[model samples]
Target: MEGDLGWWAVPLAVLGGAIRVSTPILFVSLGETLTERSGRINLGLEGTLVFGAMAGYATAVMTGNPWAGVLVAALAGAVFGLVHGLICSMAKVNDIAIGIAMMLLGTGLAFYFGKPFIQPAAPDLPSIPFGWWSDVPQVQAALNVNVLFLAGIAAALVLHWGLRATKPGLILRVVGDSTDAARAMGLRPAVIRTMATALGGAFAGVGGAYLSLFYPGSWNEGISSGQGLMAVALVIFARWQPLNCFWAALLFGGAGALGPALQSVGVTQGYYLFYAAPYVLTLGVLIATSSPNRALAGAPGELSITK
Candidate 1:
């Protein structure tokens, strides 16, 4: 019984870890999934998140309202997405290249504006009180999970259903599957793609807002450690489905939290390797899901990258 209990502990810890870490990944992956479903890829998500974090934090500090910060961050992300959309939709600029450029611009802008608020401790957002029902410390700790994490999962499920069972979802999928088909259906592919990109950016921005306001209250140059970019690959691993993105992001988040958890237990030698777990897992999932022949098992057919 003792040995069996020991075996079960690892999974429990992993579950706890997942709850703690999945929020950001959930946001970024969902955003990416939406963009990709419309046959456009916004590789600049990393930058969008970082800048949004800065903007959100600054706004919260100025307005004394965390929700305001999130709203502004969404707007900021929308602007970035709008730029990416215009560039990709108008000129011959590749989506990937534009995404990279947008990332650099976003990061640079964040650093420039974030300098003033470096020392000011802004008001933090309150957490949902799930811990109220738990007596055990461990259970309480798990229950005291971020509301954003739960919201992320809900968003994914809802978005998944929306994309599959709703008319708008069908239209977006048609646009993603074939521009010619979209035109035949009298839908503007570029417009659909642009809207999808903007929506994705908004979600990514909110995810970034969560990072700055909730998890690590306060900001610095090193606030985000690449969770944004890794989420890009996460969407692929999730097969571009919002619900799948939730599970995949949770798995990645759990992998990410393992290193710190191990260190707390006096194991510190493999810290770097453990920290790399999410990226490695993401790459592995990508490899397993991707193919050299035939389209990605579930990828939208008209997507330029997968096809």
Candidate 2:
């Protein structure tokens, strides 16, 4: 294990791990940000994430194209989002409740259909040799960033700008902040919300694609490993901002990478505890944010989670 390259590779490994481990989370948090910005939250994205992983893996196996798998995963995730949006839009329906149900439905469906795909190996997504200049193998390996991670960064920038400067972004904010205001502006709140939720689902699905088509590079029921659920905390920590989601994901990713980094340095003891760093951070953030004394700054007016 090189003992973390005589203690030097430790940081390098962590930096690499943060970028690699955070990709799926970055995607899901981005999706959740869009959904929440429209005054809705898809708690079932865990399911969407799992289902997308299955669908993407299956597609890559059948089509021999990792990109096709990613595309199909997005479409499949959109369908889940569309279903959630349409259902929640109905009278007397609770968005949170429907999201829970959707999560169950998505997981059940995936488990039933994904059984056959467990053992198959699908094509992996390619990585960019960003560390081409580095002669060290560890450095090169650490620097070989995946294309999707770069894409997620680009997405964060675009989403950040879009929400601040674009007309559609304005509508999303209006719908999230005040449904009545959106209606008064002659905009359909339900429609806008539905679209936003669908797009969010698509991004979450792409995250799934990243799991099956890239990192782990295979399909399995345990592939998601609660990362989908963790994305909610990530989005909250980001204060619903897309760019913040990017930073928050890296933070979580670094925490996630901590255990492996330690193991890489030949410190195998208590690695499990290190692995728990992200969940512990999630708990801390939630406990901190859940305080009744302080209002969540920058929260959308109509967001129900705060209320």
Candidate 3:
């Protein structure tokens, strides 16, 4: 019985850690999934997340309502996405270069705007209660999950079904897989790509909003720690499927939690190394999945990177 119990404990602990760590990744991964599915890559998602975090936290502090902060953040994100889409679509700029520019612009904007609200307190979102169901502390800890976490899973499921089972999803996939095919079918590739990028940005903004308004309230320049950038790599690992994004996010989250989990038990010798686990895992997955000899399976053929 002792051995059996011990074997189960590791998996449960990992599950808990996955949920705790996956929330931000889930949002970013989902957003990127949508963007990539439409045959365009928005590298500026990192900027969108940071700017959204600052905008959301500042609005919540000023208005005393968390929902208002969410709305404002979405708007800010959408505007940023529009700019990225417009510039890329215009044929005057390169997508990768534009993405890098957007990242710098976003960080600068967040730092500049976040200067004034650095000290104000804001209303934060509340977590759901699951602690009452279990008497054991470990069980309770594992079960106590975030509402956003569940919502993200639900969104992924819905998106998965929509992409495979719905007409609009079919259109998006067609455009992503082959712009020539989409054009033959009379679908406007640029319009669809623009909309997809905007929607992706909005979702990324919400992820940022979650970071500032809930996890670590009170805005600072260093609020986000590169979850946004990693999310791009995650989408490729997820194969642009929303359901896969959910699982991939959880795995990334678990890798991220490893460092802190070790620190909790007085094992801090390689703290920085453990902290790099997520990136290492991400790189590993990318190398494993990305092969020059064979094309990325299920990749949208029309995507610039894939071709």
TM-score of each: 0.92, 0.97, 0.92
Which ten residues in a row are the worst by lDDT in model 1? 1-10
Per-residue lDDT tens digits of candidate 2, residues 86-105? 99888888888998999999
Per-residue lDDT tens digits for candidate 3, residues 147-212, read 778788888998999999999899989988888999999999989988888888888888888888
- Which ten residues in a row are the worst by lDDT in model 3? 1-10
List, in order, the clash count of every candidate structure. Answer: 0, 0, 0
Give the poorly placed runs of model 2, Cα more than 4 Å off.
none
Over the stretch 119-183, how does candidate 1's per-residue lDDT look in tens digits?
88777776775768856565555567776777887898899899989999999999988899999
Give candidate 3's whole-model lDDT: 0.83
Model 1 residue 236 CA deviation in Å = 0.8
Indicate the residue-level lDDT of 27 in model 2.
96
Number of colliding residue pairs in model 1: 0
